[model samples]
Target: MCIENKYPHAETTRIENTLGQRPKMFEIDMLVPNGDAFEIKWRDATTDGDHITKEHTRLKVIANAGYHPIRVMFYYPQREQARRIQKTLETLYAGVGGHYYFGDSAWQYVRDYTEVDLLAVLNRIASEKTHGE
Candidate 1:
């Protein structure tokens, strides 16, 4: 995958020694740049609902830590599921900075990594404040 330096190095955080937790660790996918933090969730139709919950908790914790939490949810796989997840994400991110990309198809979200240059859409998103339409 083409690693773009546009985003800062991601730090995955988890609650330590929390055994027997159904969700295990809440991996906080983040890019910290200029002292601000952005949270990313690359999800497909098959993505577990639990993952979304965990990510939201992680975002809340990040915000509690005094960092700007930007939640970016990339939903692909199916239009109907994408729309569902997009709406859910919108509600979760109300008043927060974030965006959701409902890809036309799964390939659209992975084209670049698959030698199809599909990342243009994601690149534009990474540069913009939000993703819609």
Candidate 2:
């Protein structure tokens, strides 16, 4: 989902000075409803330094705000790179509850599966303040 915010009464001076009339700060490619966020890089995988850097920055901001943030790098139409990214995400979030999947299917299966819906699982976890069966 794309969220667009028009300039109304919120810091036109700063926006003009920093962005020089650019309308977008950043485009969030995909947001998983359970709170995991992702930015996709489909092609031109050779030039992903900027994308990865920005994704980590966003993740840090969200984490500092006390929310779980996950960065998913998608190399769509490139199966080899996608698999590599999948492995990386799995290893990175191995022991963390909020870090799994990051909206990707391959790494998602690395975690244990319950027959419950995501919300149900999340609610149970929240109530218990713990993960695992």
Candidate 3:
């Protein structure tokens, strides 16, 4: 809803999943026409190897659809396996000419792209809630 409000033209596009026996559609987080296809995650601590393959395929699909794939993960995992998976994902993103941002960089990217100080706004809301409570 924030994306729709901020970027009136931004859309959440669906891609059909042909790999599974049952047909399904994968939702791309947010896409701006002639711009970036964003895959956003609050945190991804997936240690599953399949996750990597799935992400790789998703990136390819975005690229094939004529959009630059960009990943924004606000939190980086602490576990060793999860960190390794994150690293692999970072490499995959770079391999396909996509950009990956994590931690502070992720927040900065959102602020830069949306021209809004999202973190500050969130902090203000949090402060208000704490004080009101």
Q: Pick the candidate with the highest lDDT.
A: 3
lDDT of each: 0.50, 0.39, 0.83
Poorest stretch of ten by lDDT in candidate 3: 17-26
The better-scoring model by TM-score among 2 and 3 is: 3
Per-model clash counts, in order, read 1, 0, 0
Write model 1 residue lDDT over 1-133, tens digit each, in one string.
2223333354554443243355555454544544345444466453567756755665555555555654444544457765665567656655444433344443443343235554575677776846552
lDDT of 2 by residue, 41-110 (tens): 3333433444444434444444443444443332333567645655544454443334544334523331
1 or 3, greater by lDDT: 3
Q: How far is candidate 2 from the true structure (C-alpha RMSD, Å)?
A: 13.0
The model with the greatest TM-score is: 3
Q: What are the per-residue Cα lDDT tens digits for candidate 3 across 1-133?
A: 4456668898988877555533366678998765688899989979699888888877776777677989999889889999999999999999889999999999998888887777888899999999994
Measured against the true structure, the TM-scores of the candidates, in listed sequence, are 0.47, 0.34, 0.89
Which model is ahead, 1 or 2, in terms of TM-score?
1
C-alpha lDDT of residue 43 in model 1: 63
